[model samples]
Target: MPHITPCLWFDDQAEEAAQFYVSIFEDARIGAVSHYAEAGQDIHGKPPGSVMTVSFELAGQPFLALNGGPAFRFNQAVSFQVVCESQQEIDTYWEKLSAGGDDAAQQCGWLKDRFGLSWQVVPAELSDLLGGPEPARAQRVMAALLLMKKLDLDALRQAHAGG
Candidate 1:
């Protein structure tokens, strides 16, 4: 099978960003490091043989970071969805990764990380509710989801009750 992974280009904080991402998600780990060889890139502020690339995983998703120039940045076009089970988990992740960025509820359990990386912190119960046989109940749940950020299950149920 062919192997493929996302390669991220960072101005100079590839390693730091990798560490931050790994710390935020479960099942995350740094695999290896690649450094520049002979040609020194003083322009990028790193020595000739310095670390330039980092291989890391977030939520079992493999990602590579390259210490390239500031030619690209993280945008809302791509985001990560963190399916959470409890409010405690949502609070923890929200408090941790929401640092240095605007944490606003975007309906249906979605928030933007400090780096402007969008994330959806949804409850596991959402799957159960959405999978229910009753179409009206599911519609109610959907309507409720449109007004939430962290996906409060209790509130969603109440919304289903027309409350």
Candidate 2:
């Protein structure tokens, strides 16, 4: 079967965004880089030899970042969800991805990174809590989550425990 890789569109920061993502995730590495050629310069308006695309892997998942100019921008409609095993992991990802980001955009584990990419730094326990047998607890968890920016696992747990 052919692999399906996610391609991210960036105004002109494909290489920079790829490197930033690689630095934040474990087991990430930069792969092949393609530069824009003179042939498409007339249409694309990008300088020849400039970075056109950057192939990279983040935690073993392949991704492509394209320097597609400022024609498109990222919005909240689509986001990358990062499942975290612990609060510390969530904190690390939140801090790294949200650095220089819009503070107002953060809520219920969702954050917009500096590059305008949206990310959900979610805790693994959230599913179990939200999908447990008791729907009341799930409601409580949701209520607690809605009140904060970055999710607080302890608060969710407390809400689940009927605190």
Question: Of the candidates shown, which would achieve the greatest TM-score relative to the real structure?
Answer: 2
lDDT of 1 by residue, 19-125 (tens): 99898777899989998766656456666776799999987789998988667877767767777778788778766766776655354566666655677777767
* lDDT, candidate 2, 27-126, per-residue tens: 9999999999999688999999999999999988999999998999999999999999888998999999999998989998999999999999999989
TM-score of each: 0.78, 0.98
By lDDT, the best candidate is 2
Overall lDDT per candidate, in order of appearance: 0.75, 0.94
Off by over 4 Å in 1: 38-47, 104-107, 161-163
Lowest-scoring 10 consecutive residues by lDDT in candidate 1?
Answer: 101-110
Model 1 TM: 0.78
Clashes of 2: 0
Off by over 4 Å in 2: none
lDDT of 2 at 42: 87
